[model samples]
Target: MPYPDKFNDSYSETKADAEKLVMRANGREGLLTCCIRPSSIFGPGDKLMVPSLVAAARAGKSKYIIGDGNNYYDFTYVENVAYGHVCAEKTLSSEDGAKIAAGKTYFITNMEPIKFWEFMSLILEGLGYERPSVKIPVSVMMPVAHVVEWTYQKFAKYGMKVPQLTPSRIRLLSCNRTFSCSRAKEQLGYEPLVSLKDGVKRTVESYSHLQAQNHRSISKASIFLGNGNLAKTVLWEDAKQTVTVLLLLAVIYYHLFTCGYTFITAMAKLLSLTALFLFIHGMLPSNLYSPLLSLFICCIYLLSND
Candidate 1:
């Protein structure tokens, strides 16, 4: 494969540089070295990929497909990657095999080029989450990702945490990344022991704590919000209530703290305004009438529509 003149990210750039360095030192000082490039290494002990997927799922972000969802990817199991390394080392042990394998790079995969979104769906479904059904085009997501990446680049040093969405990641999610493992198989005798299907099943089963059923624990705030069918509809539990409270707190903070007035004075003024408003509104027909019945119906409507 032809190397690009410019890489999308530093991670890819560094990997390519490291491979070049390793290949350069292949025959020097009687040292044998070869680079084994594994495609999307994932399995039971995976920390980054699986955890990130679960986090996205919980955050309600995993319902989106970044592209048409037909891009092919070669995902190698973690054990298969390790086995590839072993194969490279064993190949280097023999003179004939060393000539063919050393000073070279070999792509390692499960040899199962599955549709990228299909693989993601399998994992998400296995973990008891809804499969991503909404297709979003790459062109639509790329500009947003670029803006986010640019923001992160500027604010990253100012206590801003790294963002997950970026242009490179968008490309990764939408582009085909399958690589042929013919070189590895022919030169180093490398073949995946675990199939991709079994690897995904094992990976999903390993992260049992991230399952949807295990994640839906009722919080204290939900209990305080009445915890009935009507309450659930109106408050919508943590996602909605938490956001509402945060916005409310921001307003309160600006008024009470950022303003010139003292905290006690601001509190008194706020309470006074609240009491006056409630007193006036309490005399209204809407409040005097069956408010519960009206509120219940409104909540039901919002719940159904939402």
Candidate 2:
């Protein structure tokens, strides 16, 4: 089945897709549907959120806590979420399936809501790192996010798809989006096996082992501090060069497909294209993007009305 355009947003889309799938399986003799919506999942070998935070702390990038850092979130251990899914699958039957049918969503959190900053601090402390001290207000961050997103979009048309301080990310940092896992507990009889503290201990232990291996590998070689710094600098420079090449390619592609004639005219067209990109980039700030994008869309409506 095709996903609706409105499902582009994560919250809406994920729930919408689950509901659609469940509805399709309804009334089938052997089919049963169970939707387990897990909260912010963290465990060993996680690459996206938890590991990224750990890396950022190690690299001295997690010292700045954005917004009030007091926002609460329901974080679930990966094993717990998996356990809930397994329980649902085992219990879901055609006779009992209707009890867990379409539009019935279960929150699969650990039933513990922790403040964002506290969670970060716990992870850092577990890893033998200092907790963050700097706190930036959401109001001050909104404009900076706007500019960063604007810069990315403007250059992206020129082939620079650089990271932007998007509005959604800002909201994630600032907004309180805690969910209750009562439904999962009641229906699937799901319970989280690992506590947050135990999870952090396990994660830190694994990271320490990996770091020790890295140190051993480095010690085996004749590598010095200067050599490490030089290698890092070279890698950073190479990445910048790659982005520049991609930007040039984007400009060339835009000119080729859009029928812009002569160098001056083509550059002018590119400027207009870049402006549109900048507008989109500006809309990328996690705090401002949602409202700004809606406004941009509204303006399009007003203009079309004429």
State each model's CA lDDT, in order.
0.80, 0.66
The TM-score obtained by model 1 is 0.74
Per-prediction tally of clashes:
0, 11
Model 2 CA deviation exceeding 4 Å by range = 1-15, 94-103, 157-164, 209-306
Off by over 4 Å in 1: 217-306
Question: Tens-digit lDDT track for model 1 on 240-272?
Answer: 334334433554665587666888888887677
For residue 4, model 2's alpha carbon misses the true position, in angstroms, by: 14
Best TM-score among the predictions, by candidate number:
1
Q: Per-residue CA lDDT of candidate 2, range 204-237, in tens? A: 6767643423432323122332334343444443
C-alpha RMSD of each candidate structure in angstroms: 12.6, 13.8
lDDT of 2 at 23: 63
| Model 2 poorest 10 in a row by lDDT | 216-225
lDDT of 1 at 114: 94
